[model samples]
Target: MNLFLILFGKIFVFLSSFLNLGSGSTWPGHIALSINKNFLKDTLTKRKFKIILVAGTNGKTTTGKLIKEILETNNNKVFHNEAGANLINGVASSIIKNSTFFGNLNFQYAIYEVDENTLPTLLKFFSSDFIICLNLFRDQLDRYGEVNIILDKWRKAFGKLKAKTTLVLNSDDPQIASLGKKSKAKVLYFGVDEMRKTELEHASDSTYCPNCGSKLLYKRVAFSHLGDWMCESCDNKRPIPNLEKLVSYPLPGLYNRYNTNAAVLVSKSLGINQYFITRVLKKFKPAFGRQEKIYINGKTLQIFLSKNPVSFNQSLMTVKGLKGKNILIALNNKIPDGRDVSWIWDVDFERFIDSFKNIFVSGDRTYDMAVRLKYSFKNSHQKLSVFENYKEALKFGLKKINRKEVLYVLPTYSAMLDLRKILTGKSIL
Candidate 1:
């Protein structure tokens, strides 16, 4: 019966893939497999599989991809959600699609990027051997009520895990790092020691302590609220960094440094050779739209995706040091990208007031972005050009940019995909 069910599941998946339907569309296949788990228990049993789960507000995709690469470099066959389907149904689909007849997962290990809110649900399906908890930030408030809510859920779920599991946590984020204290599993942490780039003294959020009622004290801040912090009353503080040093990348920003550190720690914890980890880190390329570069018609265009205040501020900081003569920005208020659209004010656009040569704004919220730029550069030499249409905006912006000078284009999530379609003549998805 188990063999028959597995064969049926494989056939369904093969047909779905051949039909050009998304791997996520195999939900029915997963349900059928779940029903036969008991019958297939013998084939699935006696298999010691390693599992790595990554969860956070941002950087999940990049970190997950990098960790998968490092694991694969060590000759480990890893099954992962490469298509970015992180929900429960997506995980189920990936498992069913990758398994063979007789309910055997051919892969030696599994690495999944679990969504922050979906971690509790996925935890019930599979017990993770290792978990990487990245920083938490306010994102899509309509969907996720508050950062604290997610943190509380994580704490409750992690408390129920077995003691053998290992957790790799980011100490800089008070919200995320606090979860390690409750987990019965072994915990390893990574963070920056020296204070390089901290947020402004009067930044939003970062108030109230997660442990006790006392206010959290900041020794150094990286951005918004992420930094070396401690609570005086309850004695809550950032966890000690186990992977102290980090390999530097071409990407400019303190946040990228944190990301690199997190990835390095995961690689080391997985028992990967140090030599291979360093080699991969040096050769790592920025994920698409996260400082991705492209060339067209004898001109170089650098694209950076900025969806929220933290990301937008970091992207602006990255280009502030560059001697760019032309700039283009795209903003949108779509569902997946964001709906509030008011978070733009939190970004530090004042730094680019006098640096850019020409600033082009385009997207569904092009006028809103233009007004923000106008206020930022109210007394600067740079002028704002608004185009309601993305294609026209891209044409005009590219025409104004000289081939010798670099054109920096920053767009939100939806706007970035739309701009990529216009620039590359293909869909990024």
Candidate 2:
């Protein structure tokens, strides 16, 4: 029975591969195979592979990619969902497509970027050898009611894990680090120690104590609510770092420092040697739309996608450093890009008011973005143009930006995809 199931699974993957539908389609096919318990068990049971599960509200994609690179540099074959399909079906599909006729995976490790809400569900079938929890923020209020709800669910789930599993946690994030205390497994924490970059100027999340609901005090803030914090009312505080090393990447903003440090610590814990990690860190480039650069007709345009408050602030900081006179901003309220557009108010848009020649707005909620910008500046001379259509906005914005001056384009997730389709002549989704 197992042999027949394996043969059928292989045939299904072989046919699916011919369609060239890309990595995104693999999850739907994996879901079809997971329905039969014997098929899933028979295939996955034969593999002796290390599993690394990355769960967080943000930075999962970027950090997971970094971890994969570190492992691969050591000649380890890794199987991962490159398209950010992190749900149960997506993970199961990646396993099915990558496994052999006898259900053996032809990879040394499986690194997955999992959604925070689906971590407990995915753990029931797939056990992770190492789990990295970055940080939790209020995101997609329609889908994930609140940050506390996710913390509670993860607390319960980590309590049931095996004692031998290694948990890599971010100490800067109070809510994520709190989960480490609940886990019976060996916990390893990573954090930033630079006081110069710790002070945050704006209102951020994670300001209150997760334990007693009292206002938490921060010794220093890296970005938003992420910092060296301690709760006054309870004994609970940010965990002591097991690995205290500063990462200086070429990327602008302090947020990347946290991400780089987290990746380095996790790679070291997995025994990937510090020498290899240091080499990879120095040469690594930013992922698509996360400060991706492109040239069009002898003109240079930098594209940065800001989905949430923390990311928006970091991207804005990077843009502010560039000597650009022209800037394009795109906003959307799609399901994937986040429906709660109110988070825009939390972003620091005042910093770039006088830096740009003109700001062009596009996306489904372009008018809302325009109003937000209009409210940020007192004078109308800053130049704000609103376009309901993205193509028109891009053309108008690009035409105004000369070849000598750099154009900084910031868009939400869906808008980024739509912009990519227009620029690259291909739909990545």
TM-score of 1: 0.88
CA lDDT of each prediction against the hidden true structure: 0.75, 0.77
Candidate 1 per-residue lDDT, tens place, 187-276, comes to: 988887656654433333545677786888887777767778889898888878886566465356776777777887878877789887
Query: Each candidate: how many clashes?
Result: 0, 3
Deviation from truth (RMSD, Å), model 2: 2.6
Off by over 4 Å in 1: 1-47, 197-204, 380-382
lDDT by residue for model 2 (1-429), tens: 555544665576666566755444354435455566544344554568888888887788778878888888888999986555777666666766676766667799888888889898766665678898988876776788888888889898899889868888889888888786767888989887754555665647677787888988888777777888898888778888876566466466566666777788888887888788877877887777777887877777788888887787777777777666777888999888878799888878886677777888889999888888998886774598889998898888878888887778889888998888887787665
For model 1, what is the C-alpha lDDT against the true structure? 0.75
Q: Which ten residues in a row have the lowest lDDT in candidate 1?
A: 37-46
| C-alpha lDDT (0 to 100) for residue 342 of candidate 2 | 90
Best by TM-score: 2
